[model samples]
Target: MNKPTSIRMCAASLLAGLSLLLSGCFITPGKFTSELVLSQDESFTFTYEGEIFFLGLSSLAQMGAANEEFTPQECYDEDTFEDRECTEEEIAEQRAAWDAGAETRAAEAKKKAEEMSVMMGGIDPSDPEASEELRRILLRHHGWDRVEDKGNGVFDVSYSISGKLTHDFMFPVIEDVPMTNPFVQMIIRDDKVVRINAPGFSAQEGDNPMGGMAGLAGLAALGEGASGGNGADEMPDLPKIEGTFSIVTQGSMKIRANNTDEGPNPTPTGEILTWDISPRTQNAPTALIAFGQ
Candidate 1:
């Protein structure tokens, strides 16, 4: 196979392997602005504006699986293990092999989709009505002011909620959606300390599952269709990781720990911690604060 073909094959295999490890449910942050405010009196408010993606139901995962079927067989030199052109007979043989296994692969794919549907509360990602169903589900929640289905499992949404910090709080507590990972979380400890973490805002692998998928998809796109050819512009648009996350605290609240580059900056309201998120952001935003006795 040629270089472009080789790259596509490798990328497809990598995506297939990753899909196995990931759950059927994944919610990740896209371009957006998010903020959290903690007061000295234990009151809090949070707001998020931008895109939220459902990876499993998106074309990203589907494309990864679909590409595998088109991967051409590659032949190598026996002794040197270097790439070599295949004989016509060898090409024909490989083609025959692929055709023979088509049925088996199709059956396997169907079975996997069924399993994923069960995992996602019987909502089938492949179903034509799935996107509208998800939109309706999100609109039923309190903070979702607007939920626009952008197709391919991405939604442009606005969410804002406020309440006293008497219990732990998590953004995107959607009904019927499996709790795999949260975009933001605030945990109130017994000693009145509040720990904040925003994992979905980062591009790190462990921090956001979509980040890893986006990286792989980018690599896969580098093959023929993406380089310079008739299909160059036909490549699917990949998800972008860009956002701003801020945490504001009352001046009286004690800051115990944080991971911002410049730490907390003094503000008239109190102190502010900000993270400018991008594809290169390796660590998620985090902070720890406490109220006075």
Candidate 2:
């Protein structure tokens, strides 16, 4: 007779199996705030700060392995294939096995966390002096930017980008490339911002890499005739995006109109515009900044 495992253990194992299939395409939800400061001479400066949160299976695996309170039991007898009672000794033995596996699971979890951290955070959360690979990518696409140390888990970035580039066709293409994965883009025409696109994250389309395990686990449970399985319409509660965007023009320039889809607030300072945004899908704009001529 096959050995019985805890429902949680089976769920974790099922997730592990699914993790392999859904590795690359996962959505992460997060928040951001950005400001575009434009000079009268057409020089442009943009600033951004934000945070993202996600759940990875490695975290789940670590939790499962570390938890020893839960016990596994065989519901049927091996001889007559009838119902049976699980003994205290059997539960203790199974708990011991899980305990032995905890160390290995912890190590694996650490490695996976590191990988995901780099992919999402773009830098080590603990080390600020580490390589600026993500920053370099931003420079290549946006402009040569400066990073300011905010001293307490905060970063303030300023970029002096080419104003001429905004009006060019290549701006959106360059921004959307896989390497940068920038959340915001601007398109200018006739020395004015004709359109701005903030295309949000990949998480909106059900590509969340972290939630893939739950999806697979649910399927496995349903296949096994588990009565408590969630319905197909139900989805994991994942993070969504909320943020603010602003633009201000210096000197004689004026924002004749705010054509952005978000319909941000206009500052009393004149030529200053702001938008509070919540992104629901990739195709939907979180914030679009348009300056009227």
Candidate 3:
């Protein structure tokens, strides 16, 4: 073989090895991209009873929701045993128990936020000079007015969301996913989004895994408005659930919307990018974007 060709081959091999080393030494592409999920919503507070896989780490922190709806409905299903209807006093006791549980979860979520505040080294998510780009995105698209520094990466996101679900029966959908929150406080370090977690969501509607009237009934037991989530239960006011997500800077983009209005849900359809390269005519570099499967 020609000497030049042999030298070129060796260079390619060396570059490949370097890429592998850098990924392991710092963070893998998968790990880095998953972070995009953090920026998408802003909070990651949910029950951590299961394993969490994001941020290149097996787990970061965890979240807990109020168990105020454990009404023991299934306990009396098979009435071969002498089971009697719960007395009014018993019902009151059960409701109080659930309320207490919800309060406990709320406190735990606040503590986690505080810990994350400590964890993100006190980077203010609302600082205009801090995560300026993110702030702009919120303002332009979602009307999230601003962020307030709570002494950490955590910031109180203020926004107004007004929409109605058209349905004959009052149902609930995911106001926030079980794992991510809308009023998400974000911490940016080295120009990346981090510390995605938030409060225990007070309510949701329609499409929850724990579905049907059971879930709605559970929420309604909270009181006059916690069930269907009143107007005050809009976007900014309610506590939110965190989701498992990732971000890839300028990686790939996917756009899908909820299709519950239709008879059935349709698959997410969009331009799918399977390679990593950009054209140079416009003088732009790629950015990391989030993706979900």
Candidate 4:
């Protein structure tokens, strides 16, 4: 099964360039809430629950139509210094073709968005026996275990993924995977250097094991209407994405500590920390938690 172009882009580009530009994209508004627990025995667990609104999908479809209909004045006469303007009939034909193409693309986008919306909205963090598919997603994507729905868009989960770190502050450089891949991770230095455990992802890996609708490169132009997004001036007003992430952690740990950079800070209460996470447009949201020896 070939992976979608959007997934490939996410796996390859989200961390480096796209991660920084997510807010300007067309990710629907929603909330992500998570709880992480690291035991004294050097083990960790993470639970996440949240929703991603798909109301903006229609706008995205419209953007696709716009892109399809766009045609640039060309230097059709290569040897001449004059640019060739498209005739009205030519323009009409182009518009018709674009509309025809956009209809198919728009329909596909709409279907995908609706499916994703249902799946995301089905997460009941409070349910002890939530969808097994959702549980599988958490485990495979984030290496979490004992996944439990916390109800009301909260989750009771923990991360079982653990690895040793090289230094107290050295961020483990995992090649290919984006830092904001919506997956949970942990690292521990076995040489008595230090141990670090962290769990994240209030939303289970978007809409798939590879990547979600966010990975669709075909939808790239759809984000043009987003606030501060490309072509925003001529584009229609895009709906504002609304949501936040409430995170809590137990055991001994620090979030975004050391020399590593971090996203917006969340409220901290002893071991619990909460962040205001908005809908991501370019890349998935991520938080880094650290433990000091």
Index of the highest-lDDT prediction: 1
Once model 2 is optimally superposed onto the true structure by TM-score, how far is the C-alpha of residue 154 displaced, in angstroms?
10
92-196 per-residue lDDT for model 1 (tens digits): 888899889988989988887776776566788878898888788788889889999987878999989999988989987877666666778899888888899
TM-score for each candidate, following the candidate numbering? 0.81, 0.42, 0.22, 0.34
- Candidate structures ordered by TM-score, highest first: 1, 2, 4, 3
Residue 194 of model 3 has an lDDT of 30
Model 2 lDDT at residue 51: 45
Q: What are the per-residue Cα lDDT tens digits for candidate 2 across 25-45?
A: 232224666677666565666
lDDT measured at residue 105 in model 3 versus the true structure, 0 to 100: 74
Better model by lDDT: candidate 1 vs candidate 2: 1
Task: Tell me the number of clashing residue pairs for each predicted model.
Answer: 0, 6, 32, 18
Per the 3 Å backbone cut-off, how many clashing residue pairs does candidate 1 have? 0
Say which prediction, candidate 2 or candidate 3, comes out ahead on TM-score. 2
What lDDT score goes with residue 168 in model 4?
A: 35
What tens-digit string does per-residue lDDT give for candidate 3 at 1-293? 43333444443443333222222211111100112221122222211111111111111111111122354321232556534566677777877877778877778656644543332234232234543433343346443444443321233444333321111111111121122212122333232323222111112222441221122223222322322324234211211223222222122223322111122112242232121111111111112222322
